[model samples]
Target chain A: MLAESLALSALLFTIGVVGVLTRRNAIILFMCVELMLNAVNLSFVALSKVHGVGGQVFVIFVMTVAAAEAAVGLAIIIAIFRHRQSVNLEDINLLKG
Target chain B: MTFDLLNPVQLSSALLPDLLLVAGAILLMLMAAWRPDSDARQRTVGFASIGLLVLTMGLVVWMAVSGLTASDKGVIAVDGFRWMVDLVVLLGAIGTIALAIEHNVRDGIVQAESHVLVLFATSGMMILAGARDLMVVFLGIEIMSVAVYVLAGLNRRSARSAEASLKYFLLGAFATGFLLYGIALVYGATGQTQIVEIGNAIRRFDLTNDPMLLVGIGLMLIGMGFKVAAAPFHMWAPDVYDGSPTPISAFMAATVKAAAFATFMRIWYEAFYNMFSGWAPSVWWLAVVTMVVGNVVALSQKNIKRMLAYSSIVHSGYLLVAVTAASALASTAFTFYVVAYTLATFGAFAVVASMQQLGETDARISDYEGLWHVRPWLATAMAVYLLALLGFPVFGGVGFFAKWYLIQAALAAPAGLTILAVILVLTSVISAGYYLQVVRVMFMKPRPEGAPEPLPVGSLTRAVLAVTVVLILGLGLFPSRLVEMTQMNAFPRYPFSPALQMGQPQFRR
Candidate 1:
């Protein structure tokens, strides 16, 4: 059971990573990051059955932190959108080296 | 005294400084919101934040002097290393707020909330300095990164600032994902979240060769690599530093990096000491690449802020040498190096902040041409700061010794990182290419015709420069005092007690 669940979690995490790399929309990139975090949460939940409650407790902390990050991340996206009228990564090029 | 975190009262007391800072930050947040945003309100809150940081520094020193320790089951460290890093973080915060109070008026950032955010971020850094558990480390990093994300965009009037904020937020969150997954996997492998317990588990269970543990450590390294802005993972840094307001850039460069590095060292040294063979080579490569990339790229930079950002990256490489050493002396060296680097970084950025004209963001290296002709003292101080960053002897003061100790630590490691130490030297010489270019521009070039004189140095900024300059030179001349202090504060080696382990909850029930 643990092996199957862990394998599923890894698959989800890899998909999230690929999405973040390929997606140019700012909001999509952030959603992908959340997806990655949730994938890790799944692994933690699966591992808790093998280990102890620590993994389960870590899942709660991850969720709380991810929520906080979502709040800040959305507010930042809004701030940028106010200036450029677009949430596309390619358009956010005012700070290039 | 030792803290037993399982006891509520002891946990609270163990967290006294962090609690105090958080409480103070909340009160200041209320004060910041009491009035509509204005320069006066921002300045008032900025000063109050400085006062609060100073008070917290006092408490940290008191705790360090009383020699507090944490039991093995505790999730927070109460040791000399934490106290020293806390002092550096608080000092950086104080300098940052002082510079921001004056610089924000010029940039038209009237939000008092910016200073309050710095306080909140600082409290987070304090938490990071002492966090001995993976969960606390995650919380601390998130708190610090979230506040800094907003501070980067505090100049709502500037699209550049907003862009910087967006990029930092996205990359920072991505890094957090890798870090969290690493923690989850490590937890799965060893069934423990506490760093000491993980170490004990690895030793007791002989999990050194376990694939799960190795991959977990690798992921954690990648995540920390991004945070410290080591190269390959450092693509976000130069842009973010260039676009953020100058004082915010200084805060990110100094205190934020210091806190992150402190936690990074603690986790590696305390938990993974037995796996030194497995990790040292990876870190050795990281140090070398970070140094070479930072210096070589900085050489071609036209913008002064970007150049400093790259220089900060190079310093990260040097600190990584100490990490690779993974010795008690390396921690001491890391502490000393962080102090010197913080002072020099704040001083350089103070000069950068002062040179800006109202509402302009021109920080080109060319703009500093012949500064000596107009403002001799400021130009000379900039020279001192740049030379220090270059790690020049005598004039660069503590900067010289910072590198000296780092090299010593690298060479003295049991792994004998001779090649890495040599690369460190070669890269330091290459870094001189850009650091000296700035010095030459300030001293040798003639003033451009009809160039407007730089604004009068604000009193607050002037004080910051004077203090940093004096300390850099004084400590440069008499570094033995700091050397002794750092040596005394080195990470306690193998503070693992069987009695304390018995108190910990079993992971493999």
Candidate 2:
């Protein structure tokens, strides 16, 4: 059962990576990053059940960090959009060649 | 088994240095916020920040002294390597703040928040230096990244600064995703995240060849590559260094790079050492590509900051050379090269800050024409820095020894190390093309009319440059002392040593 859950978490992580790579919208990409974090959280819980304790603690910590990352990431995205009036990766060419 | 929160021994041993920095950061923040309008805010921040750093230095010294007598904590790993790196990080932070105080005030950016940023960044670096677990490493990286993002874009009026900050943020976030996922995969394979435990599990399970572990390690390397701006992942560097305030650029080149590399060394050498054969070749190629790209690209840069940015990339390549070698000699070389590079890079940026006129125009390479005639001291300082960057040895610079150590490490590799050595030597020769250009333009070329002359050097800036010059020259002359110190403080690469590789050696006939 634990192996199945862990496998499911890995699948979700791959989906997140695919979303991040395929999506062009900055917001959607960031959502994919959050999804990746959530997948890790699930894996951490499953592993905690396997290991007895430490993995669950790590999962709690990971969630706290994910929340923090979301706050900061959104704030930065908003700031960038405010300055340029766009959130598309292709539109953010002020820094590129 | 209840843990006591207020345990005196735990507080004294495990948490004091971090506590010192956090307190100092808050104090500087409050002081800065207290007088947003006062000119003295910069001074206050400068003195207070330096004072706090000095105190932290004392604490580190105390820790080192006690560590000699104390037992090791596998969870925290306050070992020789951590102590050595902490010293380097603190020194880099102090030098950067010194430069920042002068640069900020000159540019009408004397907000205490600048000081706050330095303190916060230093704290983050401290966390990174001591982290023994994946979670702690992630936290340290976030703290460092957020502060740097603010520092990069502090000058809101400049479109370039805004662009630099955004580029850094987006790329940095992407890398963090790779790192987190890598950690998950590693956890899957090893069922542990502590560096020591991970190594133990890898050995005990004989899982070095496991696809999951290999992918996880590769992702982690990619994540670190982005942070260290290794070849292919270094897109943000030139623009960010060119656009940010010169002092912050200096900070980025020195403190941030040191912190990242410190963690990289720990992670690669400790948690992942068991699988060195799998990763060393990849990192070896990374080192070669990074050196070649950094030097070759720098040759065409007309802007001094951009040139320095590329030079920094080359320096990262040099450090990576040491990383891939992964021997006692290489670790020592890594520490020595880091010190030499930090001092020279910061010194070079300090000269840039001194040469920059207040809000007048961007400093182009042409801006340096006839610098020798106008300000000999500043011009000479820039020349010294360029020579150091080029690994030139006249007047006794340690850059030569730093490279020698790297070569020594490459030689220690059982095979194919000669190719790394050849690439390193070739890149060093290639690097001279750009480093010499700075010197030639400053001294050889006739003065261009309307080019900006060096501004009067402030006391803080001058002092910082002087100290950096001394350290560079001193280290160049007698690097053995520093090398020995680093060796003594260098973290042990363990478990996966001869013991783990006994059954599955890479070079077995």
Candidate 3:
């Protein structure tokens, strides 16, 4: 059961990687990243149950950090959207290839 | 709160510098918010950040002196390793603030916020250097990453700046997830999160070939690779550097990289030393790929900012080479290399900051044409930096010695990491293609007609450039002492020690 949970987490992380690479909408790409975080949380909870209380403690900490990251991430996204009026990742290429 | 009759201090003395930085950041934020409309507030904020940094430097010095008589505390190790990194990070912060003064003066951006962000970032970097636990490492990363995300977007007028901030925040968070998951897996396997505990667990269990541990280490490396902007994970670097304010770019390139490398070394050397054979070979190839990709991509760049962005990536590869040889020279080689690299790279970016006009100005290689004629001293300073980056001999640049140590260390591996040395030299030569292009345009080519010369440089900038030049040349000529200093500061083990195997099973899980 622990192996299955970890495998699921890995699968979810791989999906996030694919989204980051392929998604053009900046908002959607960021959402995919959040999905990745959720997957990590799932694994943490699963591991904590199997390994005793430390994993649970770590999961709580990860959740706190995730909350902080979400706040900052959304703020950055909103700021960029206000400036460019678009969230298409490719369109925002003023920095050049 | 639960203590015996004697209540021990929760805060480690090792964290004194970080505490000062945190307090300074909050104070600056309040001061900035106190007089939002006043330019005086901004100036105060800038100076306060500089003052706070100076105080932290003093604290670090005091700690270094005190550490001689003190024993290691719990999870937090404050050997020569942490001191060497802290010095580099602090020096980078000083130069960044100097470069930022003019940029903040011209733009009405909340200069105080910038200072606050930098303070937070510096504190984060220090904690990163001193982290003995996985949780502390994660905390340090977030604190640093959050501040940097804001700094990247500090230039509100530019769409590119905002875009860069968003991209960096998202990707950074994404990487943090991988890091967290990796840490979780390691904990699950080892039943411990403290690095030493994990090492002990691994040794007792003899889990060297565990699949779970392998995955965890791989994921952790991916996360750190993103932070250091290693190749394959470095797609965001050029755009982010180009988009952020030039001074912030310098800070990101110099201090953040040094801080990240510090933690990278600590974790690898202290926690994962038993797995050195497993990780080093993969990192060796990653270093080669990062160097080649960064320099090769930079070669075709027209914009100087973009070029430097790629240059930063190339530097990461060089640092990775040092990391690949983490066992070499008691980890002092890593610190010396970081110091040498930070001084040269930050000085180069400081020069780049001076080249820009008000708002966002494009500084192409062509824009530097006849710069030697217009600003001989600035050009000379930049040339010194470029020479250092290329590890050239005329300047006796320490970059050469830094590179030499990394290769020598890598070669120490029973495996032929000599291949990595050959790659380092080849990639370094490839790097010359882009670094020298700037020099060629600045000195050899004539200034473009009717292009207004850059505004007179600030006194602060000149002072920074002068100090940086002196350090670069000093390190180049007398690197042995610096190397010794780094060695003395590093944990007194070079190559993996047998004791490290004791903790292998904990890390294996």
Candidate 4:
């Protein structure tokens, strides 16, 4: 069970990384990051069976941090969108110089 | 593997500075939310934050002087080393706050929240500096980074500021993911989250070759490498620094680097020393590329903020050399180096902040042309800082010792870091090429035809600049006392650390 769950968690993490890299839309990119974080939580839960409750405890903390990050991250993304009328990463090049 | 939880009193005593800063930040937030209308209240809030930082600095120094040793059951480590870092972070916060006052008003940022965010970030840094467990480190980074991401975009008027904030947030969140994943895998491999316990597990269980452990270490390196703005992982720094408000740029350059490096060293050295031989080579490559890329690439940058951003990256590379050496001397050198970098970087940014007030944003290096003719004092201050950064003879006093001890630490270690030492020397030369350019523009170039009227220097800014300049030269001239102080304030080891594998033993050696 641990091995299979770890494999599934790793697969989710890989997809998250791929989505973050490939997607140009800012919202999608952020969602991918959230996906990556959740993937870590999944692995933590799966590994907790072997490592004890420390892994479970770390998951709760990661969840809290992830929620905080999402709140701040979305607010900033909306701020950018308001200025540029788009949340596409390529459109946010005013600072590229 | 069993451990005991610390008592509430014991924990509070150990965490006094962090607790105080948190309370102060909450109070400041309440005051801000209370009075959104009055400029007088805003000024009061700013002074209040400064007073809070000063109090925290005093508490940290007193604890250091008293030689208090407070470790809380392998979760938090409080000793001279942690206090020394706390002092730097607080000083950096105070300087940034002082710089922020005028800039915030000019740039139309809500003044009270800026100060509140910085206080919260400094508290997070305190947590990071004292953290002996992976969980604390994670929590600390989140607290610090989330506050700063908001800070970067505090100026909602400028579209670039929003861009910078968004970029920093996305990249920062990505890095946190890498870090969390590393922690999860490391825990899976070792069944532990505390540093010393992991070390003990590695030693006893012989899990060195576990794929999960190795990959976890690599991911953590990438994550931390990004946080410190080392090359290859430093894509976010220049754009973010260029776009953020000037004082916040200074804050990010000094405090963020110091805080992140503190945890970087604490985690790698304290928790993972058992795997030192396994990991040193990867760091060797990282140090080399970081130095070369940071310096060589900085030479092409026209924007002063981007130039400093790259220069800060180079400084991170130099500090990484100390970390890769992994010696007691190296850690001590790292502490003094943080102070040195903070003084010079903060001083330079102080000058930059004043210039930005004179109506220059996204300033080019050439904007410095004829600055000497206009404001010789500011020009000279800039010279002292740029020279100090280049580690030139007279002003580089602390920088010289910083690099010298770093080399000495590398040399003292087995022959592994010889190449890194050599590369460090080579990159210092490469860095001079750009530092000298800024000096040339300031000193030799004739005053430009259309230069703006000089900005009046704020009293608070003047104080920060004066103190940093004096300390830079003072520490440069009389470095040994500070060196001895840092060396004496060795890291506190966990109870589970082997007699042969701990910090006090290194001092005895």
> Each prediction's TM-score against the native?
0.97, 0.93, 0.94, 0.96
Q: Give the i-RMS of model 3 in Å.
A: 1.4
Fnat (0 to 1) per candidate: 0.88, 0.35, 0.66, 0.94
The sequence of per-residue lDDT tens digits that candidate 3 reaches over residues B1-509 is: 21121214544444668787888789788887776545566667788889889999998888786653223235465656776778788888877877786677555465567777888888888888877788889888988998899899987877878878977887787788788778877887787788766766776786667778877888899999999999999988888888888889999988898898788877887777777666776777788899999989999999888888888899899878777765555266667788888988889888988887776546677778899889999899999998888888757388888877777776774444677778889988898898888888889988889977787899988888889999999878888888878877777643345544343222110
DockQ numbers for every candidate?
A: 0.90, 0.47, 0.69, 0.91
Candidate 1 lDDT, B1-509, residue by residue in tens: 88888999999998999999999999999999998988888989998999999999999999999988877788898888899999999999999999999999889999999999999999899999999999999999999999999999989999999999999999999999898888888898999999988888977897878889988998899999999999979999999999999999999999999999999999997787776667777887898899999999999999999999999999999999999886667888989999999999989999999999998875999999999999999999999999898889999999999999999988887667788899999989998889999999899999999988899999999999999999999999999999988887877643343223423221110
Q: Where does the lowest 10-residue lDDT sum fall in candidate 2 chain B?
A: B500-509
Off by over 4 Å in 1: B494-509
| Interface RMSD over true interface Cα atoms for each candidate | 0.6, 2.2, 1.4, 0.7
Whole-model Cα lDDT of every candidate shown, in order: 0.91, 0.79, 0.79, 0.85
Candidate 4: residue B124 Cα off by (Å): 0.8
Candidate 2 predicts chain B with a TM-score of: 0.94
What DockQ number belongs to candidate 1? 0.90
Q: Pick the candidate with the highest TM-score.
A: 1
Weakest lDDT window of 10 consecutive positions for candidate 3 chain B: B1-10
Question: For residues B368-434, what per-residue lDDT tens digits would candidate 4 score against the true structure?
Answer: 9989998888998899899888888776667777777777887786435677788899999999999
- TM (B chain), model 1: 0.97
